[model samples]
Target: MKTDPTRYLARLRVTPGYEKAVPAPPSVGVLIVGYRACFAAAPAAGTPIASFEATTPVQIDAGAATAMALISVERATQRLRIRTEGGTEISWEENYFSAFGDSGTQWHLLPVDPSSHGGFVIARGAWAAGGYQAVLTRSTLIQAPFAPAVVSVHNVDPHTGERRW
Candidate 1:
């Protein structure tokens, strides 16, 4: 079975009093805080899974002025990928680690199901950047051994925190 790709809008909020300055002035910095997970079609519920308010934000060399979260979900597997300009690509997988707690990076595993898995990839990062972008790709099963994949891209405006699909 083949399924058409779907797009969903998502947002990232700056943690109150959690912003930090980058070593190189005027450039952008990022501190990622993984909060919770939920379905892309639904809203995020419950408290955050992790917190980075107490941790000091790390300075990274980024000039793009935007952070990105690349989420991919395929049969029995899910991954969250993060990247910024001049920064190394960071990734978290559902089955790989229990809970990541290092250098302000954190993530939660998605709930498992027989047919498909559902969850949202929530994270917070402060940067000189304007907004955050999230791209989600999922393979959904409509029949046994046959699944169709859909992709969703979401952007949030830093000024208004408005989500645009």
Candidate 2:
């Protein structure tokens, strides 16, 4: 799987999402971790969704990085789960959490210290869970007035991997 563990906050600030290109400071930065998957938001059977029974509302797996877990108002019922694996000695430290979600989603926050060259997993279970994201903070959590936007470029047939548009 792909991963971003080295100064993710700093790395993410350069992207074209924040209100200001540069983040607040070393003490604060916002990171939006997007997951790729097809979700069945509306269940056909009833109010209960089958897929949600197998997994948490939000699940995050990271390699060589400390991960911050979050959810939105829609996913507030989802139970946040986190685990770390590596040689660095995983530690569950108290952290801060705030509101995170596009339309509906509930998020949670906790500091994770993974071992050297190790990995971690954070997940939750919520049938009505919506979209979610999180970030690792050094000093304090940073809340920006603007939200990040993701743009994807698809290339039909190109070995060079250049955007056709």
State residue 105's C-alpha deviation in candidate 2, in Å: 1.2
TM-score of 1: 0.21
Screening candidate 1 with a backbone cut-off below 3 angstroms (N, C-alpha, C), the clashing residue pairs are: 38-119, 38-120, 65-129
**C-alpha lDDT of residue 122 in model 1:** 38
Model 1 agreement with the true structure over 77-102: per-residue lDDT tens digits:
23545555554554444445435422
* Model 1 local distance difference test score: 0.27
- TM per prediction: 0.21, 0.21
**Candidate 2 per-residue C-alpha lDDT over 1-165 given as tens digits, one digit per residue, 9 for 90 to 100:** 443333234222222353363333223333223222212121111122112111222333332232332221232223344546533433322222224333333233322222233332222222221121233333112332122332111111234432211
lDDT of 2 at 60: 33
Displacement of the residue 52 alpha carbon in candidate 2, Å:
22
- lDDT measured at residue 20 in model 1 versus the true structure, 0 to 100: 55
